[model samples]
Target: MGNVKKKKIALGLQLLIALFLGGAAGFFLPQFASFYQFLGQAFIRLISMLIIPLVLPLVVVAVAEVLGKNHFQKLLGKTFLYFFAVTTGITALFVFASYYLGFGQGVNIGQEGASLEGIATGVKIDEFFLNFIPSNLFKALTDGALLPILIFAIFLGYGVGQLEQEKKEAFLSGTKIWIAAIYKILDAVILLSPVGVFGFIAKDVATTGVDKLLGLGQFVLGMYLGYGVLALVIFPVIAILYKVNYVKLFKSIGDLVTLAFVSGGSSVVLPPLLKRLKKEGYDEAVTDFVVPLGYSFNLEGAAVYFALATVFLANAYGITFTPQALLFTVLLLSLIGKTAATIPSGAIVVLLAAAPQLGLPVEGVALILSVDFFANAGRTALNVVGQALAVAVLDSKKEKTEKVEKPAKAENVTGKELIANAG
Candidate 1:
C-alpha cells in the first residue's frame, strides 16, 4: 500500500475566512447583521469562559515565582517596571502620532444620528479612585470588574509568596496541575473559534454598508501607523539594547502571530504560542509569566487604538482639548489600555471609558463599533508577538547573566582533571 501524507490545517487560514465573511456581511448587507453578531458574541463568550480561570492560577504561579524574596523579586520588579515605562512612552508616542498625523481633522462631519446627549462623558476623580478596591468579591465577578479582581489577585499572590518553602513548593506543584488543566480546556475551545469568526464576519457584513466603512478609514490608518511605530521602532530598539536579534524573533513567531491576526483574538491561539516559544530556546517560566502579564498590563495595540479612536470620536463631535485635557486623556488611556483584552468587546470598554472623560460623544463610538472586532485581530496578534519578543530578550539576558560565573570554571577545569583528582 502506498503511504499518503496527511496535511494539518492551520488555524490561521480558518480565521482569515471568518474575517472575510464577517466583514463582508457587515459591510455588504448592512441590513441583516444579527447573524454576525451572534457568531462573534459566541466566540467572545467562549474565550471569557477560559480567561478568568486560566489567568488566575497562572497569576498565582507567576507571583509565587517572582516574589521569592531573593533574586527573583529584583528580576520581576525590573521586568515589570521596564514594561510599564515603555507602555507609557508608547502611549505618548501614539497620542503624538495621532495629533501629528491630523487624524482629528478627518472625523465624519454630517453623520449625526447616534446621539449621546446628557450622557456622562466625564468621570469624577474620587469615584474613579474608590473603584480600585473591591467592596465585594462576588459583586466584582458578577460585573466582570477587572480592578477589584486585580487587587484580589495581588493580595492572594502576595500571600502565596509568604508561604514556607515546603508548603510553597506543594502549592506550586498543585497550581501547575490546575494551570495545565485550564490550558487544555482553553485549547479545545479555541479550536472552535473559526465558526465564531465566520458568524461574526457574516453578521457584521449584513448590517453595516461599505460606504460607512470608508469614512472611518483615516482613523484606521492612523491606528495602524501608531501600532507600527511601537512594534517596529520602540520594541525592536529595546531588543537591540538587550543584544537580542529582532529579525530572528519575528521570523520565529511569524506563523503564530499570523494566526492571531486571522483569528482576531490572541487568547484563542495562546496555547500553541507558549509551546512554540518553548521550542525556540525560551524558558517556560518566562513564557508563562510574561504572556499573562502582557495580557493584563502590556496593551500596546489597544494603547494605539484607544488614542486614535478617541481622537476620531472627538473630532466628530467638534471637541478640541487643551494640553491639560490631552495629558489627562493620556493618563486615563494608560489604565484603559492596560485593561484592554484580546477580545472584541475590549474596544467598546475603552471607547466608553474615554468618551465621558474627553467629551467625545459616546455614541460616536458606534461608528467604529462594528468593525472594531476585526480591527483588533491584527492588533492583538501584533501585541502578542511584540510582548513575547520582549519577554524572550529579558529572560535570555537574565539566564545568561546568571550563568556567567559557571562558565569561567568550565574553562579552568576538565573531566580529565576531575578524574585524576578523584583517583
Candidate 2:
C-alpha cells in the first residue's frame, strides 16, 4: 500500500509537470500542435477502445452480485436518489447564478462560421426515448452508445442472477475473469497518460489560443468558479457528512484527478478510480455499481457547465427568461445532463439539441465552443471527484446500516442459543 501511494504521488507530480510543459509548448511552439494533437488523441482512442468491454462485463457482474444480496433495492434506490438530487440541485443553482451574474452579457457571437455541422439540433422526443433501447446491441457497442449498453448489461445481469446457483456462479466467474483481463490492459494504457496529457493540453492551448479564451473570459471564469465551489466547498461538506477524510481521499486520488482534468475525459480515469475507491475500503459492490452509474447519471460537473452555458448563450442572444422560463430551463438541463456521458462532447451535443427549444440561437453555441476546452477541463475533473465522493458516502451509509443490523442478528442468535441450552 505504501509503495502504491508513493507511485501515485510520483505519477501526480509527473502529470502536473507535463501539464506545464505542454502548455508552454503549445504557446511557444504552435507549429507542432498537430503532432501534439495526434499523441493526445491516440491516447484517448486507446482508452476508449477498452471502455465498452470494461464497462459491460463489470456492470453485469456488479449488478448480478448486488441483486444476489438482500439489500439490492435499497442500495439501488439510494444510489439513484443521490445522483438525481445532487445533479438537479447543481443544475438549478448554476442556471440562476449564470443568469443573475450576467455571464454572457456583452458577448458577441462573431464566430459565425462555427458550424453545428455534425451535431443534430433540436430535440426529438421519440428518437431520444428510442435511443435508450438499441435496435441492435452490436451496433450500439460498435458506436459506443453507452446508455444502451448499460441497459442491456443491467437486464442481462438480472437474468443471470435468476439462473440456478451453480450456473450463475459459473457465469459470474467467467465474466470476472474477463473484467480482470481488461483491467490489466487498462492499467498498461493509463501509464502512458502523462504523455497523453501533455499532448492533449498542448493541442488544446495551441488550437484554442489565448485571445479567444480571453474574449470569453467571463463565461470561462464563471464555469471554473462553479467547478471550484463544487470540488472545494460542496464535496468537502459531503465528505464530512459521510465521515470520509476529505483531504486524504483527494490526496490518494490526486493523480487520477489530474489526468481527468488534463485529458478532459472522465472515462479514461474510471479504471483507476474504481481501484482507488476499493483500496479506500469502499464496498466493492457499491463502488462498482455507483461509479459506473454515476458516470451516466450523476454528472455534477456537466450539470454546472450545461446550466451555465445555457444561460450564457441566452444572455449573448439577449434572450430573457421569466420565472417560468427559467424553471423550465433548469428542468430541461437536469434531464439533458444525464445523457452527457453517453456522447462524445456530450454536454456540447445536448446543448445544441436544446438551444432551439430554449429560444437561444444555435450560433451562440459555436461561440461558446471556442472556450469549451478550458471549461471542460475543470468540469471533467469535478465529475471524477464527485463520482468518487459518491462512492465513499454511499459506502459509509452502507456500513452504518450493516453495523446496526449485525447487533440485531447477534441478539437473535444469542436468544436461540439460550433457549436451546435451557431445553
lDDT per residue (tens digit) for residues 258-363 in model 2: 8988888899888788878877656888888888888988888888889888998888778899978999998888876677763335678889878888888888
Residue-level lDDT tens digits of model 1 in 197-292: 777567655755666667667666666776777678877888888888788888777766765665567676555666577666566666666776
List RMSD in Å for every model shown.
Answer: 6.0, 6.3
Q: Which stretches of candidate 1 lie over 4 Å from their true place?
A: 1-5, 17-39, 111-132, 142-147, 251-256, 259-281, 313-325, 339-342, 359-363, 400-423
What is the lDDT, from 0 to 100, of the residue 190 in candidate 1?
Answer: 69
Please list all clashing residue pairs in model 2, or write none if there are none. none
Query: Candidate 2: where are CA atoms >4 Å away?
Result: 1-9, 109-113, 342-344, 396-423
Worst 10 residues of 2 by lDDT: 414-423
Each model's lDDT = 0.69, 0.83
What is the lDDT for 294 in model 2? 88
